[model samples]
Target: MVFDAPPATASHSWMPSSPCGPACIEPIDEIGTARTLARLAGVIGLVLSFPVLTAATPKARREHMQRRYARTALRCLGLRLRIVDHRHEPVDGFAAPDTGVLVVAGHIGWADVLALAAVQPVGFVARADMVDWPVLGTLAKLTRVIPIERARLRELPGVVDRIARRLADGQRVAVFPEGTTWCGRAYGSLRPALFQAAIDTATPVQPVRLRYLDGDGNPCTVPAFVGTDTFGDSARRVLRSKGMTVEIVLEPRQWPGTDRRDLARRCADAVRGTDPSRHGLLDTEWIAAGSTRVQDPSVGERGPIRRTVMATRW
Candidate 1:
């Protein structure tokens, strides 16, 4: 199913002011056609394999198939995924190969879902409206996804509780605390309310950043699945193009120690440091946590992040 349009200011397709400028219209149209065919083929394949996956025990085969499906879909779109700075990335503290986890990450684009799924057997919290989408909705449910209504924030506790139970039983889950997708420049202040489970169980939170590089190696506007971005057009644009690199950057897991808000702040701070931008995306107050200045003898880099954002939240 095609996603809705992203917000106007956040649009990925920018029209040049000069009318005579080269048009990407033709390429976009062609890509859209290819995307349509791939989506149909994907749906058919999923239906055909359903019974076989259901019958398989231990499900390693089924899970690997899911990863393959995601990989194939991305490849058909001409999108390449690159992982960076993961050498020292720590494993999820409570994540057993068969168990579940609460993976809290930054939301930037639709690619994130596919990229994350390609790594492990996991689930996501999607909007209730997504359940109405044609093939995509059905496939999402098949992946053990749980849908939530955006209007009903009060039901969050019950929803998260259900997810926690799944995690306790060994199913990894991902949540975007920004509550929405955005350009990968900075992290939005996380909603403390959704972080209750970490506080309650001291569960580890995985912080990730998604960066989309253009053909020229510049940061491109990622296609968010929601908001005003046109899903069909965006899907076509991404699928047909080559030279784009989407990175699924996974960082070490953060353990619960302080207050809920403080934990959220630290997670956000750690994620912000990963931005390719020279200045970290964190607020000034956040940067003030330690000796904010130093005559650096080092080659090139901001002085160490001595102050901790977690301390300020209190």
Candidate 2:
């Protein structure tokens, strides 16, 4: 099945764009055809059983099921998830019930939503058309994602208000502030619009750095759904790739001050780890204030955390 790309909005000139495309992708080792077919079957089975698994389950249990489903889905697609926590007090996988936090990340592709949910089941600010997609549409509804219409600029405030309400009620909500997807090798700037919700509710902003890596631990752009590529195109590429790892670096949380632009820029800087112009893998040092030891599960140990030089308003 083919999904048509959204038409370019003539009036929405601020929509983010990226120069990375299929050419930016590096060929990686692929699983055998039989294995690929088996993985595809696994994915189909999971998608078909999702509703039955989630149906009538309590909120906590449903979230547990969602996390398992997301991890299983990634495994079915031959992707491994590596989470790096840099927070002073590391909450279990981005879920904090007492208070709400706005999770922001560098947009990669459709799989990004799955990766975040795998860590902690959180509602997403997604494109309005995502609710109409095939099996994913059902998943979107189950998660109660907040849909945003890019073409309708006037409706943005309403979307922001909805997100603010969710945050105010102490519900974790994730959003890709870049406003568009980019190849894993490069990313776009974080638009300040969504940051308003965090500022409005005085919620801390969680900046997550997401990247795809090959078996050799180099950046991989095979999963990017950028340019004119359709969802099917990206999916086929991912299904064929082997030893693909989704590295999620949960950076320090920035408290929302009175400036959304500053918050957006600080979050972007944290995600990018350096100048946005630089390509290739970023050597991000997990920096945080205080003496709390940060843990790196990938390395299987805890280490001293360096103080972050980024100015914090609160």
lDDT of 2 by residue, 41-148 (tens): 998899889888888678667777788899999999999999999888858878566579899998888899999999898999998888776656778888899998
Query: In model 1, how large is the Cα lDDT of residue 255?
Result: 80
Q: What lDDT does the true structure give each of the candidates?
A: 0.55, 0.77
Residue-level lDDT of model 1, residues 79-131, one tens digit each, is: 67775544264543225576555777776656677777655557887656555
* Cα RMSD for predicted model 1: 10.4
Q: What is the TM-score of each candidate against the true structure?
A: 0.70, 0.84
> For each candidate, C-alpha RMSD in Å?
10.4, 10.1
Q: Model 1, 66: alpha-carbon shift in Å?
A: 2.0
lDDT, residue 175, model 1? 74
